[model samples]
Target: MDDVKPKVVVDPSAGFCTGVKRAIATTEKVLEGDGEVFCLGELVHNEAELERLNHLGMKILDKNHLSRTTIGSHVLVRAHGEPPETYKVLEDKSVKITDATCPVVLRLQQKVKKASEEMQASGGSVIIFGKASHAEVIGLLGNTKGKAYAINKKEQLDSIDFSKPIRVFSQTTSDQNEYEDICNQIRIKSSNLSNGNPDIEINNTICGQVSRRGPALEIFARSHDVVIFVSGSESSNGKYLAGLCKSANPLTYTVTGTGQINPEWVLNAKSVGVSGATSTPEWLMLKVAAEIEAMI
Candidate 1:
């Protein structure tokens, strides 16, 4: 009698989102071309993908390195975007830049800039519901001239001065439910502070692609006996989505690549689901699934 192999399924919805794909394609095209292409940040969150790009002649640089190096011909902005100051500095240095900022993020920046202008004269403030140091949030803050406040968690809402007008926005990859709750709480807080005359403006800035993945991944996770969520350790979206999978199914495990897959995790499983973050590559997930298949 032959031993049975556990069925493996890869999540169709997993892999790069539109913004990340756009950035990677832009970087690849630049890399194929001329002298040197420097990416301001890790082009994408996946270490494997970054390593591949590095081999193809893409140089990763931070602001300090970019500022000091005056010889580069092109600096590629990742999908997360950069502050206005980053652009100004690059411009002053006469460095040509290939901006791969996501369309969604660009639009959010514009909205935040406009809202900041609207509230500036009134002593009002702009607040963001996102990780304070996230690249996107940092870029968003640039639109507000460093006047915006970032709320990493719900408890941080108390820091806002409700006496003044407020404009709120969210990072594109932030959880929709959490963002909504933040908005609702802001509204409630504002009303109580302003005698129900709150001058609050709220913008739904979360990306549709990212928001949809949460529920989709949850459903996919529950359908399988065990789940392998692949993503780079540095990817914030990966961490969030992996947590969602674990919530849906306790047997879920996270790995950066096929190399990180644990044989024990897949043993005795009847079905396995392989999924990844938006920064994760489709091929990587396929590889993970293949590895799991081989195990059984």
Candidate 2:
């Protein structure tokens, strides 16, 4: 039994991405001095990280909170940027805004805004390859003044008049492979609609960090006998990356934290690799590794 105990290895590359790191650091800096800072939404998708931040006196709020914000209160616009109207409400209520939007997301918002303006003038359409309900997608559409179409599923393509000109952009954290597939489908349909001369512009708007992380995680997944994927359950990309790990190593299992790990999953495994989503905190991953060590 001692010889068979699995050696737990936490992936060094698995942890918060640069943008999430920046957001967490910014929030921590504010919380340390300000006490009870208001965040517009969950700072990051990882629930464990959110819990840690919440314990540190971060108050998470929704859009409705914007309307009722007390005058001169400090409000944090999370990494998932908000609509212009959100800023307007905060300003009207005299809330001090600390913008912590990711730089990649901010640039995508600007590009989508400009594209929508151009499309509006020429009777074209701006299409977003992302979840319609995602906070970032909502912000992207707001930049277009509610003029852009968000296509999360291929079936939603029916809503678009592809016969007209089109521009495509993706949420910064969207699955890169999925984005490409959606773009290809859109392009093919547009060509069929417009007699092979589809007028379309697709922007490489997905975060380079997300785009590069997939391949790296795939390699990491393949290198391990068993993979424990840690991430907030609500994270969209977490599911995708975890799926990548599952694909590479069928013994992969996902958990929000150490307590969720199943001892049965690591049975007969000689080497267990632990990895996490971009929003996952490094300390959480380390704790998970320790838990795995205890289990084995």
Tens digits of per-residue lDDT for model 2 on 156-217?
99888888889999898888788999998998888786376457999888887776778888
* TM-score for each of the candidates: 0.95, 0.96
Residue 279 accuracy (lDDT) in model 1 = 96
Tell me the lDDT of model 1 at 61. 91
Compute the lDDT for candidate 1: 0.88
Residue-level lDDT tens digits of model 1 in 1-296: 64777799999999899999999899888888864688987889899899888988899998777666575578889999999999988988888789999998999999999888888888888998898888999999988998888997778888778888999898988877788888888888888863774688898888888778988999999999999999999887787788899999999999999777778888889999999999999988998899888888
